[model samples]
Target: MNTLFIFLLLSTISSTLGQESPDPVRDIDGNLLQSGTEYYILPVVRGMGGGLTLGPRSDDLCPLDVVQENLEVDNGLPLTFTPVDPKKGIIQESTDLNIIFQAQSICVQSNVWGLVEYEGHRIVSASGTPGNPGSETINNWFNIRKFDDHYKLVYCPTVCSICRPVCGDIGVKIDENGTRRLAISDVPFKIMFKKV
Candidate 1:
């Protein structure tokens, strides 16, 4: 009888211990886990004719007669600048002519290095949409250098499909009246990126 009671007590204790304990296997990785990530949606503005030379055929004149003459010669005819309706054409131009080109979002992935804080190790992914239907993936190692109390980010070595070679230098300033501004040299589009 004592043997039977001891066997029942052992079986009960084993079953209770099994039910109280938790699972030992864990599927989480310690290194790959990230806590916080930052994002910046930078606006890339490209000036059309700032440093460019203004020639006779270029669209930099006020009267614009020389440009009209060149267009007439290219068309093989004397193109007369006759307004369809003079009354409707003589109006004040008040709207802003400066086009504002901006990017959607820029994703920057910051990974923690050895014994150091997360310092933006990799630009894992980049994407941009030039206000069009089909989007484009910007895949190239853009140069990020420091210049005169600011950082210059130059995106090149990759060309866009519709626009010209998307290249620019962004200066990041951290003082008062000093803000992050991008000066795209000749391109007519913007670039955006995000973290994956």
Candidate 2:
């Protein structure tokens, strides 16, 4: 009987250690982020332009790249988060999500955010189709991670078990035209979510 009790104790400990509880992402008001609810991703740092927005691309046929508004007062655009599991309603930290803009665009039918290779750099852009979460739409997967006291956007999709994706911290790259475009960088763009 003692041997059986010891085995059960060990089993309980091992199972508990294997399961990790999801960390809920909170907004500026300290409320948990609900999936499909509109939120504005604003920079925590004062002078880093405004929230995320779509910028004009030289090629009209291609989708617009995600950028920060040059003006300090501009809130940019509002976006919604859709978790990898369509049934999940809460946005959790480090979980794959689809960041979709609430605005309309004529250049692309879908305003879902996705990564694209432009000028030898991986940049975030629109035209992504969400809902299908896997290696098929890996580029469309993004996540919010806890950074210091705020949060930052990260591109590390785990939806595909066999696909290898370019994982990195999402930051801004200032182009010659002075546009602050979102790109993969060593330094992350510190951000915070504000419910709209």
Candidate 3:
């Protein structure tokens, strides 16, 4: 299905069948989110090889690169969104989100924060996944929703909602010469999200 059509469908569905209403979609300035929760994420367009997952990452590669590189080698497993801090609604690729079965965070320590302006991209960062340590504000906040019966991380930004990862595109291969590794296409990422 077309991405726009799907988004329109989700807009309609989210208004009625959607999970939370008037639920504070973004954290532009206010911090309206609980602390310590997991929300899975997906890319706008499924890349040539795999999907986007949220989880821990080193300070070197951007968070998304962690998945992009790993999935290319290992089986393409999904990822989840863990918050850096519910108040700030920030997320960076750190061990704080390394909860078991946790979604591999893509916001690297160089660093990246997934959701805030949107909705439940994530909700508060724990001590971090088990690697590096540090945090930041929600300049790149976004949200995901149950759109058309699937999950998606929608990033229709007002300003600076997302960062630049030139190598994020499919088949782009690794970031040569220290190019940015994160990428968000015009299409929002879609994935299967369950509350388990």
Candidate 4:
């Protein structure tokens, strides 16, 4: 009876571990892309508002090289700003900017805080109140220029604030059937850019 109990316990633990393990290929989206196979894992922190973090525990994926290349190709210039932290896995374009994600609402910092421009025009700027969540003054800060045609997006947690800009060499090809396709590579989570 003792032997049977031990076997059952061991089996249960094994099953639980297996179920919780992350499968790189079968579970990862954009894992089949042809670009390259380098991935970064982020952690999801509570009370941090919306957006996902990419470090160790978050479920966001990013195609670092590909994203950068695409942005450069569209803009006709390489990214001028460096990511905040590359080694520690904290990737951000500008640290001076703050984006807030509320329940069904989004807010940005302020124009007085300066702006992120593309092609000499203010493409990314903040125009919202500091503390008011539902005020119009807090409504338009989360703005992206060429919103439908051009954008620089990276894999971020599902909440929509935390984003990592992809750098390095990468390329993307649209299929003949009018469907957007990505290459297969190892990535922790998937980030996509859509015209909206």
lDDT of each: 0.24, 0.90, 0.34, 0.24
Say which candidate scores most in lDDT.
Answer: 2
lDDT of 1 at 80: 13
> What is the TM-score of candidate 4?
0.18
Model 4 ranges off by over 4 Å: 1-4, 23-72, 75-196
What lDDT score goes with residue 126 in model 1?
Answer: 18
Question: Candidate 1: worst 10 consecutive residues by lDDT?
Answer: 109-118
* Best candidate according to TM-score: 2
**Model 2 Cα lDDT, one tens digit per residue, 119-171:** 98998988788878777899999999999999999999998999998699999
Across residues 1-196, which tens digit of lDDT does each residue of candidate 1 receive? 9999999999999998886422111111212111122222222233311111111112322211111111211211111111112223221111101111122212221111001011221211112111221113232223333333322335442233463543454222122222121233332223221222
- Model 3 agreement with the true structure over 105-181: per-residue lDDT tens digits: 34433324333211212222222233232334222433444444443444322222253422111122233443212
Model 4 accuracy (lDDT, Cα): 0.24
Q: Rank the models by TM-score, top first.
A: 2, 3, 1, 4
Query: After best superposition, candidate 3 residue 138: deviation in angstroms?
Result: 4.1
- Cα error, candidate 2, residue 134 (Å): 1.6
Candidate 1: which stretches are off by over 4 Å?
1-36, 39-135, 139-143, 158-166, 171-181, 185-196
In candidate 4, what are the lDDT values of residues 1-196, reduced to their tens digit? 9999999999999998886422112102432211112232111222212212111101222211111122212311111111212132222221211232111212222321112222332222223233222222222222111112222222221212443332211112233442222222232122222111
